[model samples]
Target: MKLLSFRVKKSHLLLVGILLVAANLRAPFTSLAPLLDAIRLDFSLSAVQAGLIQTLPLLAFALFSPLAGSIAVKYGIERVIFAALLLIAAGIGYRSYGGLFGVYGGTVLIGLGIAMGNVLLPSLLKRDFPQRVASMTGLYALIMGVGAALGSAAVVPLSQLSALGWNGALFAMLLFPLLAMAIWFPQLSHGAARLAIAGEPQQRSGSVWRAALAWQVTLFLGLNSLIYYVVVAWLPSILRYQGFSAEQAGSLHGVLQLATAVPGLFTGHLLARMKDQRAIAVTVSLLAAAGLLGLLALPAFATLWVVLFGIGAGSTIILGLAFIGLRSGTPAQAAALSGMAQCVGYLLAVGGPPGVGLLYDATHSWHGPLLICAALALVMALVGYLAGRDRCLTPAEPLNEGRLSEEER
Candidate 1:
């Protein structure tokens, strides 16, 4: 009885630790946009250069994500996660205090850490709680959304603190990862045993890369991400152009982020009940399209537009993460698919903000860029519908000697 009780307690603690880790993943990056102008002024950076700060992280995700699964295969997922948390903490410290080198170098560290966490978390969840993938994914998404919203919401206030300023504001975010690390430390001791219990299959399949459904999932994730980062990078500027104050714009940005999280509360149940997720996908895309249309046609209703867009963007992310698990038959495959999707997905996303800027620069108006994004939302609806289909990426057969096929690689 004591042993069973102890196991239950440990399970609860592990769940809490996973959620805490999720919370740390996004806040550090999302928190920065509100402070971008301040950082720019302090650093004497051009708009392109300031934009680079945002893009750099995505680039790191693109570069590092494909490698994350292999690293986990060799090092064990728990150790990789622990290393990632340390990297994030160290990166935050460097970025906030290290001057020019700190800015770029720290961003690289933070981005790589986030990329590893992002790739590993889905696999970890799928491995430990096979029956609860959607529920757990939704919970993680909900926490992540809250964390991002909090990060965005807090930046202005933190920066405003007389003694702390921008540097201190960025530095303050370090606490999240530190806290997560503390919670996660206990899990590391049993990492090998945990992997064994999860039945890490020896048969590796190289088939994910060749699967059509995998591409659909990848595109769904990529397009959704592209729309999100584009908005993240430019929404404040758009609001400002419509005559809102900087503070108002920043607050709205935070609100937008918060709205994205609202769906997380319900997505798990929704996903679990409906394997064919096309309706949800189409609905969210339309909401986003309507929001973007509102921005162009009725700038006065900025609040409504942002709220709608946020819901659409946030729901898509939930679906994207859920798809990574729902479509895979094994945890390793989930990790491989996740790594592939994020690698290509983020690579596609790296151009978004800069592209938005170039379009705005060329036309000298928000109308052109807004229209393009609205149309892309429609495209997302189409692609997401395809990805929403219930199917696995490959047959459930394990590969001989647990080796991935050269073609799949």
Candidate 2:
């Protein structure tokens, strides 16, 4: 009984550590946007060039995510996660000191770090909390929202500290990863015993790609991410163009990020109780659509539109994660499904910000880009409905031995 209790205590501590690490993944990336104008002025970059800087990490996410699964397979998730955090620290430190090349290189590293965590966290959650996937996903999303909000909110103030400068602002982000590392180091000490064994019995085949249900989940997550990051990269600038001060715009962006936590905390409960997740998905997407439309029609009301957008976008994010767990039969299956979804989904997602910027550059107006995103959100709604159904990926069966023997003979 004492040994069993000790095991339980250890498991709880590991879960806490994993979540802490997950929470730090996005803070560094998101925090930089609020201070982009200051950096651009200091560096003298064009709007398109600045957009490229903002887009680099996400592009890394698209490129690096597939590698995460293979890495986790070989190195153990806990070790990879710790290594990713250290890489993030190094990336941020480098960017804080280096010139333009350093900035871009550091950004790429941060993206790589985040991509590893993004791929591993869902799998870790599935492995650790099989029965509570939805709830745990909700918690993950909630903490992510908190991290994003804190990072976004702090950048302006941190940048103001004369001793720290913009470099200080970037370096300030190292604290979270450092804290998470301190918590995670003990799990690493446990060695292979703490790791999920490769080729375990639970790692069975499920025809995820062939399943329509799997596609739906992937599409929904992809679209949600595309829309979410587009806003993250551009919303402050968008609001500023619409007559708000840079400070006000940044604050509003932070608020929108904080609001993300609300739906994340509740969406899982709503989905678990309700038979249909489609309605919630559609509702959230439409809410986002409405916010975008409002921004187009009433740019002066940026704050109000952002609130609606946040609610819509946040709810969809929570629901998309819930579907990952709901659609898979086992933890390994969920991990495989998540890996497949994020791999394809982020590849599709990487296009959003740059594509929007290209359209803006071509048209010389936000109207065209806004319209395109709105339409995408509507399509996301339709796809989300199809994906959120209560179904799992079905595996193929082997042919009969008698028929195979006759053919071979």
Winning model by TM-score = 1
Q: What TM-score quantifies how close candidate 1 is to the native fold? A: 0.91
- The candidate maximizing lDDT is 1
lDDT (tens digit, per residue) of candidate 1 on 1-409? 9999999999998999999999978998878877989999998999878878888889999999988887887778888899999999999999999997898899999999999999989998888888888888989999998888778778789899999999899999998899999999998997786665333652353456767777788888998888888887799999998889999998888788788889899988788888778899889988988999999999999999999999988888898999899888878888888988899889988988888999998888999889999999999899888788766665464323223359856
Give each model a TM-score: 0.91, 0.87
* Weakest lDDT window of 10 consecutive positions for candidate 1: 395-404
Pairs with backbone N, CA or C atoms under 3 Å apart (clashes), candidate 1: 202-402, 203-398, 203-399, 204-399
Distance (Å) between predicted and true CA of 161, model 2? 2.1
Enumerate clash totals for all models, in the order shown: 4, 0
lDDT of 1 at 154: 85
In candidate 2, which residue ranges exceed 4 Å CA deviation? Answer: 189-191, 194-207, 236-251, 274-276, 297-302, 395-409
